[model samples]
Target: MAALGWMVLALVFLDEVLAAVAAGVWGSHAGGWPLAVLAPVVVVAVWWAFASPRARWGGPVVRRVVKVLVFGLASVGLWVAGHHGWALALLVFSVVVNGLAQLPSIRGLVAEQERPPAS
Candidate 1:
């Protein structure tokens, strides 16, 4: 159940990131369709490279920093796109959920999830 909740939260956060990037890029130019598509592609590429579990980057601190940076960008982008309610919700929910994730019990579960299953 906890793992499922984590997966759902991860998907929600990813969607929020994509939506925010698309919204920002869509408004950055007069004809934004192309840029909107390109923007998300770039963002996703960078995120996968730096933040994903299989990321090229090393160290837990770096991953945590990247996650925070991406979430911050997403929140700001949502605000720029005039989705004030969503922006606020994203920020608040991220704070609460991330805080909960820091609890000792949840932390152990997260560490376990990061480990590979025995073959």
Candidate 2:
């Protein structure tokens, strides 16, 4: 479960990077240099505010919600950016893998590891 948690974290980062790239590409097509640069900055800011490990938001629920939103939107963004096959693959991978991580047994396993041992 801990390993899965790490995998999920890595996936989250990948999703964010893909999202930033997609946004920048879209911006480049729609506007120009400023928009291209600003798109990634905005995406990163929102991600840091709502999805980062130290996000100033709710608990696990909020984090999960943000994760879904971020990855889902990024999947769409990838499709729009002309990577249809990659987008679908990412969507499927994120859904199935994240779903597994949400299983109660897996969550409990991860939570158990997070606890400090009693003296």
Candidate 3:
């Protein structure tokens, strides 16, 4: 879970970098600002979803699902809202990153749940 969280953090950082580069290339400061803010939110959301004891199921699955859906929708919305090229790229990148990051946690949770009881 910790490792997965870190992976999500790395992806968020990558997204920020990509957004900055895109913004610079396009000469759109507005495009970069939203991504800058979103990066931290992504990190926080991932951390809370994976690390927080109060999170549903006390595991990463539910959180990951929610994060994927929310982020996916948000990305599409951004794309529709005139972000265009960079936004679309970022959205696709985020989906891939989040999916990969959640894999380990989902596997671990499943393994734990599938364990046999002591004799």
Tell me the whole-model lDDT of each prediction, alpha carbons only: 0.66, 0.73, 0.56
* Shift of residue 15 alpha carbon in model 1, Å: 6.2
Q: Mark the regions of model 3 whose C-alpha exceeds 4 Å error after superposition.
A: 1-8, 12-61, 103-119
Candidate achieving the largest TM-score: 1
Candidate 2 error regions (>4 Å) = 1-5, 103-119
Which scores better on TM-score, 2 or 3? 2
Model 3 worst lDDT window (10 residues): 20-29
Q: lDDT tens digits, residues 6-115, model 3?
A: 66757765754454344333333345656646544664465455533455444556655655554555455456556777567777887777566547664465466568
Candidate 2 versus the native: TM-score?
A: 0.67
Listed per candidate, the RMSD to the true structure in angstroms reads 3.4, 3.2, 8.0
lDDT of 3: 0.56
Q: Would you list the rank order by TM-score, best first?
A: 1, 2, 3
All candidates' TM-scores? 0.69, 0.67, 0.41
For model 1, the superposed segments whose C-alpha errors exceed 4 Å read 1-31, 116-119
- State in Å the error of residue 24, model 1: 6.2
- How far out, in Å, is residue 104 in model 1? 2.9
